[model samples]
Target: MNSTTQATLIKVPAVTLGFWIIKILATTLGETGGDAVSMSMALGYLISSALFMLLFVAMVLWQIRATDFQPLRYWATILASTTVGTTLADFATRSLGIGYGGGSLLLLTLLGLTLFCWQRLLGTIDITSVSNTKAQLFYWLTIMFSQTLGTALGDWTADSTDLGYLFAAGVFSGLLLFIVLLAYFSHISRTALFWAAFVLTRPLGAVVGDFLDKPLAQGGLELSRYSASAALLTSMLLLIILLPQRAALKTH
Candidate 1:
């Protein structure tokens, strides 16, 4: 296909600083919003997970059927996936009595398997190649797993260790910074780096969200989850509107 046609086929946004900024905010919003429903409202993790899972499925379907890139639609789907990830992780770790470490291990294994299958089927797990329906399926599925894994990792680092929320956030932030350095200064695979950074951002957002909303006795600020979620949502929307993202060009 010609460049024009290839460009038209691309539906996901380009990987830019703006994209990462908005993504972190979306994940933070997901944590607070999910907690608001499941914990604050006393809906329980299982019920909340079911509700968010349905919403996530609907958003993915909408995204898959779209003919062109739509920023709002794309971010909405991301937000849905993150919210579901939060509740699902909570249910697995707390309700199932698996502990945060066990939950993180399980989700990490699932994410790795998804990526392995996606690579074996498509020959590449690069986001730039996600222009067709098959690739989109793998893309969203990988994201779902990654988001869930991230939530688990965040909780593990914060609660299961001496790191607490702020320290856990710092650790993830440092790791992400290391990835950025590798992207600029090393010869490592760009695709690998992208995925690594993408996965790490979720935990960073998770810890930050917990720090914002969890009780002060637990090393948090005890802010209202609803208010925190609203603030994060507003920030994401503002960034999306002000810094319009373009579709990632197909490389394959």
Candidate 2:
């Protein structure tokens, strides 16, 4: 590759309003898409997780190979993470008999460890530092853990707490908004808030997606998983095309 290609722009997207909009939508799509595979197709969580993990690996490889940011590729990688996250969380929480509480705690611990390791190695967990190979590896690892945690947390809130889907969605949405308030008015670290908001977005999407796809008896809209996933996918694509996505400013 040429020197210009070698010294490419940041691979991660900039932190913009459009980025969050697409992120939340992509995550919701993840929930619906994952359910289509694991539940609707009766593939079981194990098989569905394996399938989505393959796609995640492929997308991550493609992402690591590309010298510059590509919006579609980045979003594809995000989608892969969330889809795999859904089934993986299900396998751990349900299939392995861990229950949602155990699953959430375990995943949260793993996420904390991942971040601690990233901090040890990189000295900072700022998303903008995700420019080189090593940083990207840490970035994706943290994302996977956060995604899994979100799934378990969302399920725990909805099922174990008996708050139902809408209320669960509201709960997470409120938490995210509170984080936003901190980001705006408080002296808290933006990096911390970024990760906080990032992790919370998944659960918000999780409950909303469940609300759409679950049966009427279950307090959901009773929509078809395939149809719901397709609509969410289409919305993301439209937003990607319609909005602006710039590469994060390089700090390395």
Off by over 4 Å in 1: none
Q: What lDDT tens digits, residue by residue, belong to model 2 across residues 116-223? A: 999998899998788788888889989988988999999999989999999999999999999999999999999999999999999999999999999999999999
Which candidate number would show the highest TM-score if scored against the true structure?
1
lDDT of each candidate versus the true structure: 0.93, 0.92
Cα lDDT tens digits for candidate 1, 73-93: 999999999999999999999
- Which ten residues in a row are the worst by lDDT in model 1? 2-11
Model 2 CA deviation exceeding 4 Å by range: 1-7
TM-score of 2: 0.96
Ten-residue region with minimum lDDT total, candidate 2 = 1-10
